[model samples]
Target: MAGTAAVVSFGTASAQTAPGPAGTAAGTTITNTAQASYTVNGVQQSATSNVATFVVDLKANLTVAPLGGNTPVSIGETDAVLKFTVTNNTNGTQDFILSPIQSLLGGVFAGDNFDVDNIRIIVDSDGDNLYTAADTATYINELPADQTRTVFIVANVPAEQAASLATVTLVAQIAAGGDVTRQGDALVSNGLAANRDGVVDVVFADNDSGFGDLAFNGYGRATLAYEITTRNVDLSIAKSSTVISDPVSGITLPKAIPGAIVRYCLIVRNATTLTPARNVNLTDLIPANTTYEANSITVGGIALGDECVLDGLPLSDAGGTVLPVSGITGSYDATARQVRVTIPTVTSLLPVAASFRVKIN
Candidate 1:
């Protein structure tokens, strides 16, 4: 084996002659040119020579095509067609990789659902008449330079997920010469941005016991119960009533007989982790022969005063009561979180029982 020697030099030299007889000197100027070359595998190759260097932008551009029609696709539903195109801008061929950074159907409200599947890709390029699965990866793949490729994303919106509105984002990237360049992500709208405003109705079941006949010095009292029911959602009772009353029997002396008074009480509680503010109203009807009587009603341990009687019964001062039992209506107390209503006693006519309804707001 022979050793290798390398030579490196700089600058040029010119020859000069010293002055001869008659003090005259003659000289010739010489021009030298220097060149550098490189060799690989014993073959000499010309080096790149340029006064100014040009830059090639190897970034990829991605854009989404508008969705076709007005077919509503809900959450948890799949195969919804999404169209998009990708372009490479570079002097030479470049390869791009594409993938989803986040779930397209993420951030859905409770009870909302969606699905994504069935990805398809089409590429326009030369030198490869045939396309392979490696060329078009559904979720990830490489794209060639100065070329355009089309990708389809199928998404589904389920009925439960269809109620609330949401947004999904998709992204793609490219790399060249060990350097990576990323394209901006695209946003896809699910079109469910409005409030659903679903309402739930309250169902009431009644269990009432009759008040027996009252005599000269005897009075009867009855107990009534109500059950309210609702599915998944909370039920609110706004107002209710039982107009029927108990009839009184024969009496001897015309003494002062206290009229019938129906007292109402309401209890409300928060059923869900998300606490709700509620307004409850209770109303009761006055029965025949029964005068509205003044009485006390208690709610959540709060004692209601004589003013609790509604609709002008000779029980207490008729106006400006704390519990406003006037006009067969009463409002919910936010601070107390309960509702109480009382009816005043009336002059004895027949002593009958009355029914009423409660409303929750």
Candidate 2:
């Protein structure tokens, strides 16, 4: 324990004291000179022997790198991971308690999206991005000096969650068991400075002992985000038609032929599992050989007198000329010769149907 040991440099009584922060780390080596006596040539002769040497051990330094960016999450998603990193700046092994706090309520970024539920912290033991319960750890243990560890803050996103931004902040504190800046500083060295922010990093002797010891340096912080976005919409369109009659043969038969009335049905459904598809619009092209029957368009099984006629009700003060209805509305592009069905909204389970009859030439 560097934290609990006296860090003064080793030296002879009259030697100038070595300069350093303290704890375990010191100068490269300390050497001592001693005189040896030998009966040389019958006269007692004293000779200086080789120097005794001691080598300096490791030094402690801890620094946590700042987080780079925010995590993007989609609505109806689960188990999204927010990543961060922790580094051991010391020269020896260290242990750090890991803590992740969700942005508090009423806070700036925390104000939106409220909170990300079921938050869990995980350490990447194998250097892989995957997070497994077997790899979960509450604190960083035995992290070698100059080494770094990636951390994950995983959470479950609600399926119906709105499009919003969420976030979480992480903090790392040394939990003792590393190199110390000063002999006595290590006394309370575990979790160095106990979450010190304003306190100076260097500790000095009251009487100017010349050796300014750096306190156990174990404090770091970072913040990440969950950039929640709109869930993907699973939309599908189905087109089908039925023949009613033909004018050439005057055979009111249900077979397709020239001059036959073909009723085309366009079904637009939001096949999503948990979200609503918005502003859904369907488009179809009318062939030059066929002509669109007037006042033949209907939406949701109701006859539509005009484009804006939603279930026989005028969609707006402008009337049904091009109004929205029953979460559905439509328009016919006379110039482009295309029929466009505009759906105001569509749910996961409720599908909307629009139909119109086209007469073949």
Candidate 3:
């Protein structure tokens, strides 16, 4: 009793524990605290409380990328597929909606000559990075954190397009709840008061990854784009004249003079870089003081209306068929002094020439 009355030890306030929160980044912050108390000499004494705090760090991060990069396609190509991938980093469940854009041509804003037709969005459920029989979904639904889903944009290319650049763009937006079919509401940072503002609940990004921003009161979105290149169809024309005869010389030769019969040969060429040209059309203006000879149209060395493909034709569109042209027609516009030729089809493998004799007046 005498020793207890002499002195009392003051307990160090429970060591003032300061613990950092754990199981963070899920969506909410968890706080914890502890206090120290003791009975000294039959009297109760209290000490300051020890507290620890940590954020839940609940956050949503999204990223998109093209699969296999850009690609080159031919005109009239059907079911062209543009592939992409979407990833969710929310540490929880999330969904994404899909949208398309066509503006990413060579120019920043100018649209290309053609648009992708019959476009469809496909989801890769098996993580195979391919649109397979096992994968069947219209949109992404309730994806897990750090997981990826493959997507494909399938469409048709229009026929008869010149060589040019094109693009297939895709946009993704977070949907309300876990509905990939529909967009989710926006998230408000105002906490409980912000609920039901048509806004969906979303984890905000605590750190900066540039994929998305902290959603204080909004939704998350991302974009993935790909380019489609088409080959160019080039057509060229060449013209020359050969002297068949002269009124003064009365003989066919390589000389130009008054009364000379000039056989004009026009060579039309299609390069091998692109698809064949259909319904090829040709026109020429008759020179003054020159009279045009009648029926001067030829294709691949074969004359118009020829019953069979002849060696005389420089290029044959018959695919080795006996006849290059089923039918050929031409007209001399005497009123306008012009010559025109029409062919059903023309190929790029060879040059076709047409010649008509014109007499100098």
Top-TM-score structure, candidate number? 3
**lDDT value, residue 21 of candidate 1:** 19
Q: List per-candidate RMSD values in Å.
A: 33.8, 16.9, 18.5
Error of 3 at 32 (Å): 0.9
Candidate 2 vs candidate 3: the TM-score winner is: 3
| Off by more than 4 A, model 1 | 1-71, 74-76, 101-136, 139-144, 159-166, 176-361
lDDT tens digits, residue span 197-282, model 3: 22334444423222222322222322333234435557777776667777766763536787787766667777855356555677
Candidate 2, residues 221-329, lDDT tens digits: the string is: 5555666555677787777776766766554555778779887776666776655666677778887789987656666753222222223322221114333325455
Instruction: List candidate 2 stretches off by more than 4 Å.
Output: 1-60, 66-68, 103-113, 132-134, 159-163, 176-187, 190-217, 231-234, 237-361
Error of 2 at 288 (Å): 36
Model 1 per-residue lDDT tens digits across residues 1-361: 1111111111111111111111111111223445579899999987544443222221222222222322233333334434444443222233444443214234322221233343333332333423444443443234443354554443443334223332232233333322234322222221224322221111111111111211111111111101111112242322222122222322333222342223432323223332222222344343344333333322322222322223322222132233454233233333344333432311122111222222211
- The prediction achieving the highest lDDT against the true structure is 2
What value of lDDT does candidate 3 attain over all alpha carbons?
0.54
Give the TM-score comparing model 3 with the true structure, all chains together. Answer: 0.45
Candidate no. 2 TM-score = 0.44
Cα-based lDDT for every prediction = 0.29, 0.56, 0.54
Candidate with better lDDT, 1 vs 2: 2
